[model samples]
Target: MIILCEGKHDYEFIKELISKINVKCDVKDQGPRDKDFIIGHVVDGKRLSYVPIIIEGGKDRLDGNVRLLISKLRSVHGSSTWVLILRDSDSNDADSAFDKLRRDIVSLINNPSKFLLYKPSMDCGQGIRVGSFVYYDCDLKYMDGVVHFRFIFVVPSLEVFLRNYEYVNDDSRLHYAIDKALSDPGIVMQ
Candidate 1:
């Protein structure tokens, strides 16, 4: 599983969450502002860090980064990899951000190979939305299963993932945020 984050801070936040959950996975630092960071990112036998250094862009480039990364991953890993994109909504409300992201994903996968199918939906009850892009092929040699492409929006910013604790300060050390979030009793409830 590959988790792509918008910036260094976002990557740090997800890395902290993964540690809290005791999961082993690569959460990539796609730079401070989303850009073409992972363009030549090699994923098979090489290390994840083999990706080229991309030029960081403005705050509005997250969508473009997501699009490019998804396309690159599809071309390289085919249907065997699952990509989870975590992006901050920034100024947009949760609903609006989700809608725009879903649209962008749909547009990117528009008229995909005849063997692939996709669905876009939101579960209002859980405040989660999903876009499933599935590729089906029986004879492929390298990658031949279903690949799930997910876009998860953190409303306002990644800080929302943490609960307010006496020790938690957004501007302080990142460890404090991680510790406070991990220590929160409600962390596992989600």
Candidate 2:
């Protein structure tokens, strides 16, 4: 599984969330451009690895980054990879944000016929809203086999999401959120 998220804050939040779940993982700083997060856990005594890539350039670069990452993964892992894209909806509505992302992916792969678009369902808690869309058996051009794509959109941005959980304040500083999560592990459950 490969997780693609926007910015360092998203990466940190995910890293902290995985830690809160007691999942053992290794994170490597791939320098200022991006971070390589390899989340490993033992299941049935077997270890599994999930790689997460952070796109510091934000949403505008998502399509290009997705193409680049998928191309690289195809060479090593072949078509047997699951991609999860995490982005903030920002000012856009959930549906609009999802549509824009869907369009971007469709354009990226140039396989609209094999792309199955589904309306993302919204989940809300304490004024915090998020949505997700899953594309199963999606075909990527130049890749031999099918791939699965999942897009998760956090409404009004991840900062708001963290704020609702009391993990960050109005400013939503990276250290502030990390400190809150470190202090209250139960925040993950909420």
Candidate 3:
């Protein structure tokens, strides 16, 4: 299932989950910009993509859009599609929002469990206050049967993850190679 979110931070965070947990899943960082316009398409025999964004000021962020997306899934895919909205559960209307979403989308889905909205953030921080785990937070932790261990390696924040982890850090060479680049003036000048 392609885990879609609002922005890049979420994308990086999800990537961290995939890497840290080794879930072997594809997560498409479909920004809010591309979500509303997306309707439905059966990419392969297994994948079904739909655009379901229902926040504030969003074009397709309503009951109608939920129903529409589900309808498209049912008609085009001819099977149940998992449209999991991993949205932020914050502010006053958080749980209420999910309730409204479930109430609207339930009728359209073959299985209600297939459609869901969950907050994957740590400690359940809400509204705009999202305490998302950085790649550093994930580090690398393996299991040992029933118990667990930690080898806390500081992996930096979301921006650092994008830059260092994914090699999207053309902006800060100093961060990319602070010590070595600093040691060589030419590298800094370059």
Candidate 4:
């Protein structure tokens, strides 16, 4: 499984969650030095899963990063891989962000009709919306084989979700919110 997210904060937040879950994962720096891509592997019984939580630097780079990563993973892992994209809604609502991301991904892949689209649905407790699309059977034009793409939108932003407060415009405050969440394991339950 591959997890692609929006920045250092998101990357750290996810790394922390995986640690809390007792998953045996090792974080390693992958790709170019300028790009922040972290790779980890989770051992589940006899199976080992490559879970790369890639930081695309910012939301603006998400579309291109997704396209590039998916294409590369298709060549390597093929139908065995599953990708999960995590991003914040920021100024937009969750539904709008989900729609935009879905469109962006659909536009990137070849023969969008071959994949089965799953509409976004709310996870009421977390206030997050999730959706996915799956490609099955033989290889296609751009894609080598089957692949699963799933996405999640953190309502408004990660800081808001973590702090349970209104959106903070300042970058420092956003970092502070993430820092606080890192210290409080209880924040994950809330």
Candidate 5:
């Protein structure tokens, strides 16, 4: 599984969350560029390589970047890998944010074989908002397989997660780091 975050700070925070929850996975930062594109191709029927396609226009073109990454990934590989896109709901309306994200993802995928939305249950300040789908690429003869993609929105920004956790020290630092990064011109929420 590849976990894609908005920036370096978001990636670090997610790394902490994954460690606390004990989930073994590879986490990647999407960088500060307006669009960050990563592609992977199946080799020897074994694994995939991370190849990036960078475009200009900064944060405004985020959706385009994500779509490119998904399109390229699905076109080559199968459902063996799942992509988890972790985004922040900076404005407090997670539903709308997720809806827009879903639309963007669906637009890139012709017709996903499976699509599901899981609402967040903010019980005690911890929750999860998830959108899952399975899309197939018809280009590769032997690679006519599906790729699973998911979008997870962190409510009110990722600060909520850091504040609710027990093991993290200097919670204020974590909060400031994420907030500052998201406030930058290179960061886009919708």
Candidate 6:
């Protein structure tokens, strides 16, 4: 399955998680702020890279390539591939970010003849509110050959996931942030 990532740490973490599930995933190095890197990778069968930068006058980290990628993926894959947008959490504007993303998703949904989005969410990486929580109790669904959830916050650092993981499942690396999301306790933005 192809995963469009926005950060290197995200690449590593997702690589590890998918490996445990015995899924072979290609991870392109999408730097901390690099947003256009995934556009080419989605349409091409090759390893790619990009420099991290923010879009001009926009909260999104792209230079209009994100829409292009989405359009191309829909045209080429045609509802048989998964385009997962792996992004960072904007704490100050988390709600707004989600709202805008949802709106964009609606536009994609109208074009059912093309590929449709399965799960699209901006994870609040590294900056999850201290008392925030999220929960979903299911085997999680898969699209094409990938299984994706709309969104889930995580600590980017392996050290951080390891450090706080024991507070949940002490033995499994993938269980920390995942378990936290499944049994989120405390005040949340919802």
Which residue pairs come into collision in candidate 1? Answer: none
Tens-place lDDT per residue, model 4, 6-115, is: 87767876776666565687643233232222222211212234456667778888767865554344333233445666677775466666666555655655444433
For candidate 6, give the lDDT. Answer: 0.39
- Candidate 3's residue-wise lDDT over 1-190, tens digit each? 3233433443444454444444554444454345434433432334333223223233134335434544433322233233433344333344455445444443444344543432111111122322322111111111111101111111223344234333455535433333332234332110
What is the alpha-carbon lDDT of model 1 when measured against the actual structure?
0.49
The global C-alpha lDDT for each of the candidates, from Candidate 1 onward, is: 0.49, 0.51, 0.33, 0.52, 0.45, 0.39
Of the candidates shown, which would achieve the greatest TM-score relative to the real structure?
Answer: 1
The TM-score of candidate 2 is 0.58
Maximum-lDDT candidate: 4
Under the 3 Å rule for N, CA and C atoms, how many clashes does model 2 have? 0
Query: Between 4 and 5, whose lDDT is larger?
Result: 4
Per-candidate RMSD, Å: 7.6, 8.2, 13.7, 8.2, 11.1, 10.5
Worst 10 residues of 5 by lDDT: 115-124
Which regions of candidate 5 are displaced past 4 Å?
Answer: 21-38, 41-45, 48-62, 110-143, 160-172, 175-190
Residue-level lDDT tens digits of model 6 in 104-161:
6446545555444553322222223333322111122223322222333332323344
- Model 5, span 94-177: residue lDDT tens: 667666665666554434432122211111122343322111211212144544545556666555544543324464477455
Models 1 onward score TM values of 0.60, 0.58, 0.38, 0.59, 0.53, 0.42
| Stretches of candidate 6 exceeding 4 Å from the true structure | 23-59, 62-65, 77-79, 92-95, 104-190
What lDDT does candidate 2 reach at residue 1?
58
Higher lDDT: candidate 1 or 2?
Answer: 2
Colliding residue pairs in candidate 6: 33-52, 34-52, 79-115
What is the full ranking by TM-score, best candidate first?
1, 4, 2, 5, 6, 3
Q: Which has the better lDDT: candidate 3, or candidate 5? A: 5
- The candidate 3 region of ten consecutive residues with least summed lDDT is 144-153
Residue 62 local lDDT, model 1: 61
| Segments of candidate 4 deviating more than 4 angstroms | 29-50, 76-78, 110-144, 165-190
